[model samples]
Target: MFLKRIVYFSRKTLHLYLQSSTMSTFTSRINMVTGNNEWIFVDDDDFDYNQELARSAFADMLHDHERNIQYEQAIIKTIQTLSKSTKKIHVLDIGTGTGLLSMMAARAFNQTINSSCSLRITACEVFQPMAKIAKKCIEKNALSHCIRVIDKRSTELDLENDLQGDRINIIVAEVFDTELIGEGALRTFSEACKHLTIDNENLRIIPARATIYVQLVQSSFLQEFHTLKNLSETNQKIKIPDGCRHLAGNTIFDLNANEIKNYIRPLSKPIPVFDFDFKSLNDKTNFTKEKILENIQCDYDGQIDAFVMWWNLDMDEQGEIQLGTIPSWCYDDKEKEENVQWREHWIHAIYYPQQPKIVKAKDQVSLYCFHDEYSLYFDVGISPFPPKSFTPTFLSRSAVAGFNNDNRRNKYIQALEKSFSNTSINRCLYIGDGLLLPLLILEMYPNIELIILQSSNIHLAHTLEEILTNSSKQLNYRIIPSLDKENIDFQTIDMILSEPFFTKSILPWDNLHFYYLIQQYHHSNIKLFPSKARIRCIALEFDNLYKIRSPVNQCCQFDLTPFDEQILQASLNVDATIEPQSLFEYSSKKPTLSSIIDLIEIDLDKISQKNKIETINLDIPFNVDGICNGIAFWIDYQLEDNIWLTTGIENENDSWVNYSKQGVHLLLKPIEIKTGMKLSINAAFDFQQGQFSFNIIS
Candidate 1:
């Protein structure tokens, strides 16, 4: 049977090879395996047209019924009010991905009573592929006659050719990001208002204005992400270099709505920071540089670590039709909050202060908010605006993220302390792309010699060196750029250590590179910090995350299945079955549908003798009656004999570690199961390829 199966696989592979070689298109793309941009030949038909769609948050935005309904209502209101005065309405839809807004305007025009009144919609999409899809979508909805899809940016649109000399009166756009102006909304709107649209009272924008709100907060949880803390409990301390100390951290986008309560403690009530009138923006509008000082009184006595920001859009001129990105906790109406459509396209943003400040209750502090044409940033406590020419020091965002994970850091420290107590380590070889573990080991065990095999990330290596050099205690360590076995004396090496961080690791189990290294240098004397690893999973009934992968059969009364079919085919052609996602950032209720089930376990000590492929089959029973839409998977490392560290859920509540993202296998077709229903799951790990495959049998 095994021989027959192998024969079948070989024949299938040969057939595919021949089929692919028949015709191919040469293209340059980043090679994941080689970590370089290289030209490669692929089958012409195999090109993934859904690459952008697969990575986009469009599904989430489409699933947002509130946004869709509000946009349609706003469009209908604008068209109805303007038709009374004008015989024709020329509408401009900017960044019209999938052309939903333009269609909405077309539908609104169709409902008008004036027989002579005509609607001309010009939708400009910067991405040519999406513009093509938008044209198809509009044609599919039978609105091609009214809506003209231009495959160009609004800035590049020629008025005579694109609009045919028609003056645009209604401008509808949804180009905002987590940071309201992060996507260059100011520039887009300014240029459109000046060159494309008519400057009159009848002219209107879908989202008339947007108001940004911010609240100061002191969060030790968030502080760890921006600032480094002492790794060891000993007298030795890790000091930040003078250069990095005063550097302003990058604004963190897509802060999970769930994390607002889990990580932040508000120091002040939500204060309105800035307001941008989209309708009023023109080329003459000074959006280049602006600084505003708002006096805000502290509600609590605490250190201001970061500020949480969100925005509310006035969909119409009256501000009655409103859409906000405010957290659920701050909502005054409980019912509205309960029914609020959670959207990932635009979420909360967290901005770290260049320097943390301490303030007492009732003490007034001036919040300095600043912005350029493209980005918004904030400062606090009466500090002078940073010089226009000043550039902030660069800190690796990934490095800060990895170090900020207190849960992961504590586990590593505990495992190291426990391992050091039982084992005698004279010399150690650390193989990973992290600095914390190596630095901690050197600091805790000053007498031992540590060698780091830093395959990449020279910045981390330099920072590690600077930190070590500046320390009071003399530490013995050497960083080797590559794994040159000739330079290392393996006979004297007592242990191998790693945080299991690799730049190439997209999934959790990719860290198995460390295990592969152990197998390569199989030494019985060397003790491994993570002696074993297990790949585990749990079925999930996602609230909205499933939509990101699911087929969009219909959206806003339009059949979007043609677009969905293309996306589905593209995903099948190029995308992985399982993708990495920060689960905590996902807005869901009781996502966990089943208890954690171990899919496969690897004993590091025995990995050297293992086969090329390992398979496991299990029956996963549902704990709740709901739709099982996804499978969340993660890795658990047995650091010591009894000490275990999980990259999955931190608790029974299903909240994950803030920094690490987990693997989510989205089911193409969601299945409804009652409590106690079981699903047969077949999981296989290909050691040779370092990849995993899972199959669910209903």
Candidate 2:
């Protein structure tokens, strides 16, 4: 006998449960925006035990040809070098995602002619699903005879059982993140050297060494994310509490250096901070926390706001084969910089100093760099010994940064000022998580009574109280957790305002919560700050970003098309219709393949009294000859007939809003289109369900 049960986790997640006397399985549906997980029980017959393979980001990593080529070359170099001294070479590929590196080792051995030395390659993948995929991938390429795939972590491999007592002389692994040590590379190497590998002169690691580099930059733009700023050039200032001042700026943000080149002004030349020798990690001291202080000369006269960090990997022993994550500006060769392989798996990172420092040209400032086994951080000048722990700040650093955007704030301020000047708005209601809009209104219009409706996020409510306590302005405002007619009179409310940034809204369009609010609390006399919103979209031709969604037919002469099929089937079953991405981070020569078109125009005032489905169909034509890989869309708030703000590309220059993620609907099959080629798009919006659907016919 079997029983079926359904459980509700949150508004964002739904879970269904199925149970039998003999067996039970759990499945989860996650709400991307809220990041809530719902678990469900599924029948054994319906569930695929191997579905975990679909979750791996191997396609993106495997598609990185530069990384693949470098690893292969390094493996070949190590194998050839070891062959000269030793009769046999044993290689271990740690965290082997697709067995690509192990297969490369095998191919290198096969290429060696008349060689008495034989090759034995063992690859370990902790993820069972990926390990299965790696086995199949190796078998498909007919390299299964030479390479053995183990479904266990490197630490779990036993010398006698796993390797048959073979001493691993050559180790090839790519266990790294944006931060050189963030991925537990130190511990992995320490364990492998201690237990799995032979520590000898002939032993070689693919990436023999890594050097971390840091550059100081003075940018008010980057500082905005770390600290709060004055509200709209007004006397009322938003202040951070003394307790929260020591809070470390949020997690390190990884970005493409090319995308942020315009925003940052370099204060110092790139300085080599730390070096990690992977081949010589036998010492226990290498696993301990270490701090180094280097005096960096400030090149320009400016305030040092943040530091940008990147690393270079010496892929081979001689350091001839190299791979780095340095920005284009660091490259001396123009061609090399222009053709720099864009990799999603690895990129540059930015770290914020706890406090900004003022420096002049030729000023010598002590740059303190610290790293543990799995993380890295930076400090400037004399700092506390052992460093202060990151204080808990309820506010998201990214959100604070978005709130400080000058352009976005200016737009909102202008719209608000214009609306206040023209219309006599008295009782105003602000609905959203952010306090910037409501606070601006209070500062500008002190006489108007303002009520803030924050449905959730107690932290935001507390932050607002702290700001109000610190603020000198005597403002007429009230913060309400939820809307209640008994406590407040909605009938008298003249204006409703929101940045439309709701706590639960993940996608840009999810802010349609604004529309829903206006509908429920309908008053014919009420005015909206954003009178309407236009959903605009443009077809894009991504150079390499498309590979993330596309099928990998072959990676280094290995047929892994089956992996693509499995991922596609899994994605179809669970993936969201639209994926949000910071398009600015993705690099391309010519991104736009079509002229911007409006899919739907939503009038806030004219929202249907009754909940119903609203949809639109349009024929979109290509303006350029390119492959249409995906369509990028964003919301443009019509603050007024003339005053508008867009959450998409800023202008014709192709710069996007750095703070907001635009929605991308990647096409399952990319279409090669020419000028004037038209694609029919049927877009639907379900108001009742609060969902969106877009179907494109090429």
Candidate 3:
């Protein structure tokens, strides 16, 4: 009999493995092996470090300052709204993570209510561990008397048994996901209103209503993250059969409001799709699941490649206090100033329609939005007719335009052209993910014998072959899906072109997939396009980017010191964290060579599969007055002798080129730096684990 093992890697630590009976002395060991540096064997019952880490991450929610501020203010406003009634204020905090809102409600009640009465808050959390943590947090804040922590879900609360048969006056919940309702918000709210709250018309709910909004956009950048749209010129021109609709993939990501203008071009004004009222939906049957926004006029003449969606939360009934997740471009001059608050908890979602609608300015269209119990979907059409059914076909189309790319394809073509103009190649081998490179080589070197190392995606390969057939060109090429030294005749292949992409890659350095493909044959005298690669880093001063990962010891005038302490203890035990960040969207204090440090350089011709861990420690000197938030890192690929492609820091004066992924490692807390300061930095990378760690040594 054979036993199976499951392996997991922390972002900045050793690889961990789990197997049901190690068959080694005793049940298991905890990071017990020495000098292997590759694997860490541990038992599932011994530590459960992953579960602890998840609990610690709950404190991270407090770092969303905008969310905290809005909730605090809404709690205060709700207390005021219920103050008119002679009945004692009853507030229920649903899914309370850190008891932050319950504490705020208690404090607001303490301030708003007179000496005759007191405020009571019932805090409910489904997760038992989180409930315990919240209880500790409430006790630490001295709000234990006014707030009660329940360790069960809101639906489990018994009216006659748990609440002393008291009817609640106000209900507060932050139980929303990226797709507004992904966390069963509809069901939870419906249950609360029907059973938990009072029957009075004056009953109040924090975040009284939420309105969904949508705007048509033209963005290939957004589309690339979901699916590779077949982008051949002939494919772009190919018309779909009449009445044929292809549903593109649904995309959800935390889009930065400030940097959206640089990547996406808007084609239509933002239109309000629908609004969901928590107070109005007392019965589950009364809930709405579909809505249609008809006759929306297009303001621009272009291909509607995708739809940008976001929502606004009306925290109070009067609408005096509201929180919105609109991109910076949509905000007026007043809202762009320092008065407005930004949030990471809620960001815009980009949706690709069933088919990208190509239209002229002033063209009118209707959009139908459908929602299941947990998620939302949308479809678009030129006619004002409503969709026959809520469910749309899932179609991944290959129709993409050049302008939609922001001209990245043009840059790659130029680099390829420059490389080909100098070398005379009779036989070429293509090793990359996309078909663009192969198609370009075929068009440029008409007589060259080309062999493409095709991607594992058979559909994509078939699409590429179809594209070639559609062009009506006679090209000499063979698509080889798999490669090894035994099958390939290396003696005849002279040059290799690669886009350096892999489906399994998650970080910038994962492009080493390109190196691994050709390393075995490097000594055979075959040249590679990117002959060299360098990894670079620079210290950065983020305006507010570090808050997402920063320790939230205090928020909105409340002391969450206990939660912060738990996170600190967890950090002291682990060395794993390589967080993904959009560093290009941030501004570097300086672009000088002194500010930038080249961490490691790899010779594409010499790298091997058995590479060892590399470490670097240096005392870097600061030359400017700024706050050190994190270190931004990117990769530079040397395509030819002088020409290169980089995802590193690009000059603001120059146009943007590389769209490759970059990374940022934020410090535990931001530090103020001045000129003449010596900053000690140490970093290590373990290729086996595909993890990197950065430490700021005093």
What is the C-alpha lDDT profile of model 3 across 1-698, one tens digit per residue? 00001013332333334375433222222221111224343333323453354434544357666777888898888787577564587888899888888998888887874565557889998766567778889998888888999988888898878799887888998887556776777778878888888874868888888888888888766665444444354624332222322223343444554554677888888888867888776444444467667788888888887778888889887777887776767776864753445445555676667567788899988887776666666668632223342223222222222212434455567777777777777788887555556766776666888888865456556656666666445777878786765556878888887765543344567656656666566564677877877777777776666665677777887787766666555544442455445554444455321366777666666555336677899876776777887777777777777666666555422332335446777777677878778778887755544345677787
Q: Write the per-residue lDDT of candidate 1 for residues 1-698, one digit (tens) a residue.
A: 00000001011111133554664445565433223455545554445344545444366677778888999999999899889889989999999888899999998988988778888999998877778888999999999998988888888887788788788999999888887887889888878877777875768988999998988999887676677665655676556565443222455544655445756778898998788888666445458555656568999999999888899999999888998788776778989667666776777787777678999999888888877776777778554555332434334344466676767777888888899998778899998876678887887788899998876667667667778888887778888886656768788889998777766566778777777765667588899878888999988878877877777788888988767877677767656677877776665547367888889887878755445688888899988899988888899889887778887774555577655668998898998999999989899987655668888875
lDDT of 2 by residue, 1-698 (tens): 00001111232222344454455456665543333355655545334533444446456777878888888888888787778888888999999877888988998888776379988999999987778878988888898898899999898889998998898988888888888777788888777877777865768888999999999998887777667766745454444565444222446766666767778899989998888888666455566555656567898999998899999999998999998888887788999878888776677888877778998999999887777676777879755535564655555555666677888888988898789999888899998887678778877788899998876678678777777767676778888877778657888999988887865555778776767665667677889888888888888877777777778889888888767777677766645667777777775547377778888777778766237677898988887788888888888888866888888875544777866778888887988999999989998766555567788854
- Global CA lDDT of candidate 2, please? 0.76
lDDT of every predicted structure (CA atoms): 0.75, 0.76, 0.65
Q: Model 1: how far is 602 from its true place, Å?
A: 1.9
**Residue 16: error of model 1 in Å?**
14
Off by over 4 Å in 1: 1-22, 25-44, 232-234, 240-248, 282-286, 382-407, 517-519, 587-591, 606-611, 650-654
Give residue 259's error in model 3 in angstroms: 2.1
Candidate 2, pairs of clashing residues: none
What are the models' TM-scores? 0.90, 0.90, 0.81
| Candidate 1 worst ten-residue window by lDDT | 1-10
